[model samples]
Target: MTDTVTLSLADLTARVETIFRRAGMNAAQTRALTSVIVAGERDACKSHGIYRIEGALRTVKAGKVNPLAEPVLDAGEGTAIVRVDAKGGFANPAFELGLPVLAARARELGLAALVINDCTHFSALWPEVEAVTAQGLSAMVMCPSYATVAPTGGNKPLLGTNPFAFGWPRADAPPYVFDFATSVAARGEIELHRRAGKPLPEGWAIDADGNPTTDPEAALEGAMLPFGGHKGAAIGTMIELLAAIMIGDLTSPEVLDYLGTTTLAPFHGELILAFDPARFAAGRPGNPLARAEVLFEAIVGQGARLPSQRRFAARKISESQGVTLTAAEIAGLDRLTAQGLDAVA
Candidate 1:
């Protein structure tokens, strides 16, 4: 629990893998889950951080996730979609595996799209965006899950925050990474605050009966409002149709049969699109990321930084200082691991 407990990232992952296997996950599952979780902690996306250790173990135990499903790729012509076979709720591996398929297709066509059905949310979209950004491509990621909110003007819990994220490659700066959940707040974030026994921040959520409340427990029963009001709701709805129905066969046929399924797991339906900006703007590619940072720095009278810039730095810091796990989260991890180890033993 000490902040000074310096476990090499590789060593910590190895231990996580071994513990999972001892708890009944196969090697493939171990690799898939650990790789994603470690990346979250190392990248300092604390919300998606090691805190997920317990929830994942629960999904694995409740038969909500497959611990050994591997990816199988299929290709015919213009595009390729990878079926994650996450088994249940394990999606990080599928996301990792699906990247290259989309990247390769992008390399061939300059514009490529991939739909990842049936994988878990796996925390943040940054990890996936960073990979594509590193390859000099711009990416858009959209995903849907169980209903977590009513449409902005309504309260019915009929839609998920259904996150949408965008990343643009930069020549002189960190990737122009922008990620935000469509809801007022991410469910994982709400859960984190709940676990910490903290009150929900104002405007983040409403009670189950549609009344606004800052009580974490009530917020869980209620819905997270959309960010841009109707605008945010509209975007989430558009993404739902695109991510869930189009690729899901629930809407557009052109994208339907592209993946053969509409949903993946209990709450996961994801769509990712990537393009070489050269397709949009010819000569003199603009450095929007750099320019934005400069303008913001001038306004705030501080040094410049961008979205993924902080994460890039945090990743390095982790290499030097090691990942930090709050004592409470570590305890949660220990408890979750003990249950899994007992379940199959």
Candidate 2:
């Protein structure tokens, strides 16, 4: 059995922030990243939680990610498009810098798009979407990963396990948010399965020889299958253009060539679009959120749970109790802190 240690949310964030600070991230960047990391754990998204710390450190050491990044924003006049250059940093600071602009632009223009480039994105997309929704705007974000998923009917891996997230504000509760990978399962899930020495679910991936396999190790060496067959592949390909090609950043395949191994982070691109429903439905009854609540209640009454409902519930529990971290995770924090801030500087 695996050993675990319980840590309060404050402790977890403080630990994570300390490591990032030691790694040369400024307070703003450290706080932004710490928020994301803590939220992942609070929401029980283990795949995107403390487990990612080691990889983050490695990327910083490898010179693939800049810890002292300052994202620069360029806004177009008379247009709803804003571009953010992450300057080879991680996505957290860029999102922190650009999300406010996205909301403001959406409010001013009724719709806005924020294209983020030259960053390594290593967390779940739900946090970004939910943040926008909290600002009373609808939001969507799409990002491509290092290629680990194959197109339908293609044995070779040509697409990343592209993820897409959407959020809608609610009148009475947290926003209804949903985030998913086009692949049958996220590559991180496969890594977790590998760590646990467990078999993947059927249809998740294939062997190196292109035969379907449940072995996580084999699947890692092979390719992940897209969800819903060709349908998922189509969406994944669309995300490639929206998140990578259109942003003039390296595509998934191009990223794969650069990383040379799936273990490293690929500084890629992300596309986020936000819309102010108030601009469109000014005359609607009770506003967009009230209307959405009616639908949300109806769905729940029909025995269907809204997306992220469980995560929201889990957050409350985590706040009351604590997040459980593995020994290795704690050790990792210790090791990084032991290295001292001067080492990274």
Best by TM-score: 2
What C-alpha lDDT do the candidate models reach, one value each? Answer: 0.68, 0.86
lDDT of 1 at 170: 67
How do the residues 47-106 of candidate 2 rate in per-residue lDDT, one tens digit apiece? Answer: 778767777777788778888888898876578888889888888788878888888999
Per-candidate total of colliding backbone pairs: 6, 0
- 1-345: candidate 1 lDDT, tens digit per residue: 254355678876876776677777776667877887788788787656666666566556656566666644444355444444344445566667677777777777778877766555566676677678878788998776567667876766767667788887766656778787788887767888999999988888888788778888998777788887889889888977988787652222222223222232343557778886655454565754555556656844765545566777888888887876666665656665566645331
Candidate 1, which segments miss by more than 4 Å at Cα? 1-4, 80-89, 171-174, 188-199, 249-266, 282-305, 324-345
lDDT of 2: 0.86
lDDT of 1 at 279: 51
Give the Cα-based TM-score of candidate 1 against the true structure: 0.80
